[model samples]
Target chain A: MRIIAFASGKGGVGKTTIVANLGIALARQGKKVLMVDTDLAMANLSLILGMETSPITLNDVLKGDAGVWDVVYDGPEKVSIMPASLGLQDTQRLDLTKLPGIIKQVAPKYDFVLLDCPAGIGEDTLAAMASSTEVFLVVNPHSLSIADALKTKIAAQRINAKPVGLIINMYAGLKGEIPERDIISMLELPLYGVVPYDEEVRKTFYYKKIQPVILRNPDAEASKAVYVVAGKILGIEIDIKKQGGGFFAWLKRLFSR
Target chain B: MGLFSKLAFKLLGIDDTELPAEQIGYIKDISKEYSVPEILKNTFGEFVDSLLHKHLIEGVVVFKENSLIYSSSPDILELANKLYEMFSSFKRENKVLYFNVGSWVSMFEKDEFVYMIKSDTRLCEFELNAVAKDIAVHGKNIFLEEYRKIMSFVKV
Candidate 1:
């Protein structure tokens, strides 16, 4: 089982959303995937996975209030999410150091265990890193994001946690944006995949919308990019929904399925 | 210092930007090879590398019966003495003290020894309920490496 922490230095970079979608995508590939919301304070993974009402969350587990199995809820696309409590009070007084031991207890049951680390290098972020075997830095195409990501990568290294690669998410292909190669050179990690900006990512989970963009719109550019990254992780080339323009792309997407 | 040098110190895991320059050098003197006292080496022995590598703990000051025991720097010795003089009335075993502005030094007392551990962040909700008696069990190092860089400037 592979326990990977998805961390980024900055917030509002869609770390939680990508982790949720990736968990679903991996689960669709017949791999038992568990997505743990280690953000603790500002948690939205449970809501994204449509399992926000899970009474026993990772907060309970970390606080010794509940067992690990008790908090594991079945998510959409057969993904198992150890969500964090939405309650503001639940974030307080948690024995976060136990996260490593807790992850060890549940790791044997899943092929991919993705942890959504809280933004910035907080104590909670360190706990999440300590729990995971490796870290995947999620960066956007920009200097600010890359700079923050470098610090996050260094933070991961301090704890002896291996930061595996970079998944450049939310790439808009803007003219002045930092290119993928430069990002790779700066962060010093191999490219996992680049998820282009897709409106479907926001439209699906804006407020009450719970379906992840990957499953809701597999034909979406972002979804297809996620599949390619997932395929790389699985060590196999996946059949992505073909991209083109208008009618031809529609036909390719339909026939490719 | 410039951004590049700051980044370099941060990359070295000895950058504590939280603390000001005078009390502790912004760029901690991690390069200076200081000898570990024979008594401290006997108490902590070979554990320095593990702490330095695995954690970012600034420095571990073990004060025995209000007497300086482990801290190498005389300045920290003065601060530790002031800490005891200032907060002696408080009977709490685990207390977070303001040894320096922007830096939180947590004191864990057991028997007669005071284990003052400097950790980055968590000044408000800072308390290690565990590791009160035994300092070795502190699992949360939190940016103490940067703390140590600032601490290394504490001259004996």
Candidate 2:
């Protein structure tokens, strides 16, 4: 299983939105994706997916009341989430020595496990990096955002976490010509994907947008971009507008039939 | 004196910028070296004479196991002398000096304080937290590569 972690240097930079979208995108491609809400204190991924109260959460699993099968819930777009409770301090104080065993128990069941990590270089982030194989350093195009990201990269290096690439979320339009080149050069990390700051993404949950754009509006420019990224992750070329011919085509037709 | 100075300078690489003109000439004359700069010779001669009679810094013998433990600070000299007396009374082998580096220097032997010197910035690590505390306490060595140059002036 490919364990990819989504992390940001500072909070409120759409880390959850990226995880949610990536989970759906992967699932649409017939990949069994598991989205983990590891933000223990202020868990918000459930709210984003419009799930008021999951029958089981990460707290229950950590407390051993429920297994991974019991806690995983279907999200908006067929993606599954191992939910977490808000204001969970006891679980947050869990002994770090036992985290790897817990991950190993639940990791092998899915094709992709994406962890939504907390902000800052605290123990929680360190634990997440320890459990993850590849780290996605999420950032916006602002100057201070890039500066904070550099500090985050140093912290990641301290634990020897392999950085797969940088995800430039919230791509605001060309106003004064963004300094994208300078940031890429100074950071020395590859640009994985540039998710445009669109209203569809912000309104995805509220408006009941469950299907991946790669499945719905395959001809749209943003959908095409996301499909290309999804294809790269799956090690195959996918034409977003091809309608129904790819690795997941048989499953798509199985559902459509 | 001149031969000793050359040997010391050669071994330590003490540059001309760290020495006065008069001391340079005196050192040159004692070693039968005619290359003494005139001004440096005058300064060295005057400094030595003051050391002999003025009791300015005379009693300070900065040794490892001597009854007399001396320091060069004018402000904290009284407290230092009291501590020295306390140590000397017990026959303890120790002395201490306060440096501009804003740190306390304690020595069991004279050699410890004899080598205390400042560092330059260009040679040391760029990050402030990575720098050695005593070397960076003065805040001048932030420039880099200068700590190595100042090492030559230390009386090893």
Give the winner by TM-score: 1
Candidate 1: residue B32 lDDT (0-100): 19
The TM-score, computed over Cα atoms with residue i paired to residue i, of candidate 1 is 0.67
What lDDT score goes with residue A168 in model 2?
A: 77
Off by over 4 Å in 1: A206-209, A241-257, B1-58, B61-103, B106-116, B119-156
True contacts kept of each: 0.04, 0.00
**What C-alpha lDDT, on a 0 to 100 scale, does residue A115 get in candidate 1?**
96
In terms of docking quality, how is candidate 2 classified? incorrect
TM-score of chain A of each: 0.92, 0.82
Each candidate's clash count: 5, 20
Highest DockQ: give the candidate number: 1
Q: Over the stretch B68-150, how does candidate 2's per-residue lDDT look in tens digits?
A: 22233345555455545544454333332222223332322232322121222111111111112222232223212223333
- Candidate 1 residue A197 Cα shift, in angstroms, is 0.7
lDDT of 2 at A210: 43
TM-scores of all candidate predictions against the true structure: 0.67, 0.55
Where is model 1 chain A poorest over a 10-residue stretch in terms of lDDT?
A241-250
